[model samples]
Target: MGGDPVTHGGGAWRAKWWTQGEEPGTTGQWGVWESLGACDGGGGDGGDEEPPAGGFVVSEAQFNQFFPNRNPFYTYSGLVAALDSFPAFATTGSETVQRREAAAFLANVSHETGGLVHIVEQNTANYPHYCDTSQPYGCPAGHDQYYGRGPIQLSWNFNYKAAGDSLGIDLLHNPSLVQNDPAVAWRTALWYWNTQSGPGTMTGHAAMVNGVGFGESIRSINGAIECDGGNPAQVQSRVDKYRNFTGQLGVDPGGNLYC
Candidate 1:
């Protein structure tokens, strides 16, 4: 907490950096998480099981180099689970592909969590508005307080439920877990990364794994407002971090860096 943020796995996406918090405007402090869980010791050459050989595109030192005062919410185990959950991240045959995927993914996460400076959303006014009463799940956490959490700052009861269901947790009922448990918090981000086609595009996982490029990833995470003609600064900000991360990892930032 004192030294540079606890960047356990390594590092990205859609929110803005306007307030030093919130991508799409969400931010908060990183919190303590539950104990670490089972993790594979030996990394593999295949993309199905391994966790990107060197774990992430950059080492802990390199990550700190980019986000100097980043938060410590993202845990190593949390990142590993992301790889395991979506083996395609490391299953590709090319190391460039692996590095690009890892780098691109984390780059996007940095934007969402505000370089890890924010955990829960910063705009308190919109907390209660996240609840979509139309959703059958409703807002179990309360009418308000779902203004994003975790690396991706996942918001809404439906999203919490979806992420929780995939990870075998009850995020809808215990949304706090995303802020309390590091693994759970990261899992939510990964779930969205590997699954949801945010805003109405392909999943970030698909964009990188299929070589669709980092720009597509932005389209996936917050394309609705940040992509296309929504905001150029946000897109470039994400690209800058991605370029920095890939460089630190000794990889190219790839083309199509914007949505």
Candidate 2:
């Protein structure tokens, strides 16, 4: 998964906090929340403007080539739309760094979702385990509703609450939005990528932008279970994808490839 299974702390809640009257980043007025129709390359509220590839290191054609069998729900337009919510993601540092970060993020995402084949977690039997009633907020969305969804396969009630609070979506109460909304799904994945560090010492964005390398990004995602020989096969899987993606982007996959 793009994020660790454990609950995060106050940093994510405070990073994007806004006053009551201020608009959240993902709203239609903010231009980050595009309609699914637009994401699907059809007409929608996003207008006739084609999905832009200028700012992002990965172009639409490159993205399609990277995940040729990706699910229709994980739209390239949706990912481009979500970029507005985190301007620094994959855009930080030099061109090589930017491309490396993009490759790293997509590599982990591809692993988590099985080349973008699965939307929600396939293990339905583990659904109910995601809810932790200890949190005072409780699971307003039913115990099983928060089971892993989106590109990162975001699971758990507190995670939903934190991600929703940061992105201005009520994911805790409407966890299905991750699966139902394409833009929201990509935003959540970017949210975890740019903000939360998971079990590592730094965010995935930091690892790439700061020259810490791709292995650190893996550590930030599922290190507790996969890093330091915990699961070398999984680590290698992520590293192989990172290398493949970086190669596809015509960039070098820097050192420290395995966590």
Candidate 3:
């Protein structure tokens, strides 16, 4: 209730400015996940485990730094959804767990979006720039809503529509709902976090540290096998952010449990 626990790990992704098209990567990169369709048994299965009873603490300045200029759209529900869907990732009751999972999740996001909040490429609004106009809703203009809206940045018209349908909101008509309704945005994020495809049945977090190719894992989720946004260098940058934020908080920043 104080400051969201999820952001506890988001810092890692903010370490470096994830500039797209950059190369050579950074040092000690966390790297994107490349799922061989097998659970490596690194992070234990967390279906039966309970969430960390004690939550992590954060100062106002610190919280704002991580979520800078952001509004509280989903709040507690987003946290709950994140934990409920991926129980295994909620183990951070202690510093170790928090640090590991946080690192994994942030790293994954960085890889997917080139470390920057992406613009809606293939949607009704911003279609033609990134899509073929001949197709239905293939070419719209402008970086419309649903352009990487959620934590994982759900994109594309079908994805936005499907996420809206699951959450009982029509993002297609009012794509701004992702930004306007906090709950809607958070639900979309949780949806992406829970889905498992390209690299077998694993959360996006697992997909990253597990060595699933960053772009490939995201493409699976986006239903765009050709989507090359999930570059590995970006994933490493996010991991860098996670490490820095953890150090600033003086906590493990690994799993669900507080340090």
Candidate 4:
């Protein structure tokens, strides 16, 4: 529901890409991934940390429950790629804060991908609109190829380039990797969570780490259409899921559950 549904206008306007003959300016959020470096790096053994109270935020069995009839191809092992995601999602915080960040991340991702049942965009119409010919790379995978993919449904040419650059994958050329490789899909979600602040809002990670509460996160992910005087139902969906997941994790869902 972010840049994914680009025709929604809000996301394209929020996206930093320049239209043909249009002047470009800094979005402030640009270059945030300069150091993220191709999304590669360390990955520890899954389930390394001892479970916090109330067990883990998301266990394989519970995840299966969340995604009834989820694609069997995307196994729990794929979700395990997120074993190292907390550090990036939380960007180095306390253990409790990390737990909160993880819950918030998974909750929002669930909403984005429909509890992980959808590996790619359901509304395929928006696929072609993601291309920006004006970009230097020019939507390498072709127009319509950048439709929402991965856990967070990352969309837009610049976004794919950024995520690819950060994750060390060539998303610009091979956008299918998000759907093809489940671990890559989850990592791309984390890449977005840890990096993108979304139009006019703080990064979801910042929203959680700064104690700004869950509403800020909603604002961060889809605020343009779902914040303040925007759609309340959509906002409530995210809040309800966050509350549910937090409750399951034994952590308070924090205040300001709506944008």
Clashes of each: 22, 0, 37, 9
Q: Which digits, one per residue and each the tens of the lDDT, describe model 1 over residues 106-225?
A: 788888878888888988888888888998768877988577988888988788888888889988888999888887877788788889997856888788888888999899888899
Residue pairs in clash, model 4: 38-165, 38-166, 38-167, 38-168, 39-166, 39-167, 39-168, 127-144, 128-144
Evaluate model 2: give its lDDT. 0.80
State which candidate, 1 or 3, has the greater TM-score: 1
Candidate numbers, best lDDT first, in rank order? 2, 1, 4, 3
* Over 4 Å off, model 4: 1-57, 90-95
RMSD of each: 14.2, 13.8, 15.5, 17.9
lDDT of 4: 0.67
TM-score per candidate, in order?
A: 0.75, 0.80, 0.47, 0.74
The TM-score measured for candidate 3 stands at 0.47
lDDT of each: 0.68, 0.80, 0.43, 0.67
Task: Please write out the lDDT profile of model 2 over residues 1-259, one tens digit for every residue.
Answer: 1222111110011112333442212233334222122222323333233223346767566687679899999998899899999999987887789889999999999999999989999999999999999999998879888799999899889999999999999888899999989999999999999999999999999999999989999999899999988999999999999998887665789988888
Task: List model 3 lDDT by residue over 1-259, tens digit each.
Answer: 1211112222222223343432211222442211111111113322112222333222233433444334354344444544544455524344544444444454444444444244222245453233223446532333343355655666656666666676677766667666555556556665666554533355554544444423333434442433344454443455466665555444543332110
Evaluated at residue 146, the lDDT of candidate 3 is: 37
Give the lDDT of residue 223 in candidate 2.
Answer: 95
Better of 1 and 2 by lDDT: 2
Provide the lDDT at 41 for model 2: 38
Which residue pairs does candidate 2 place in steric collision?
none
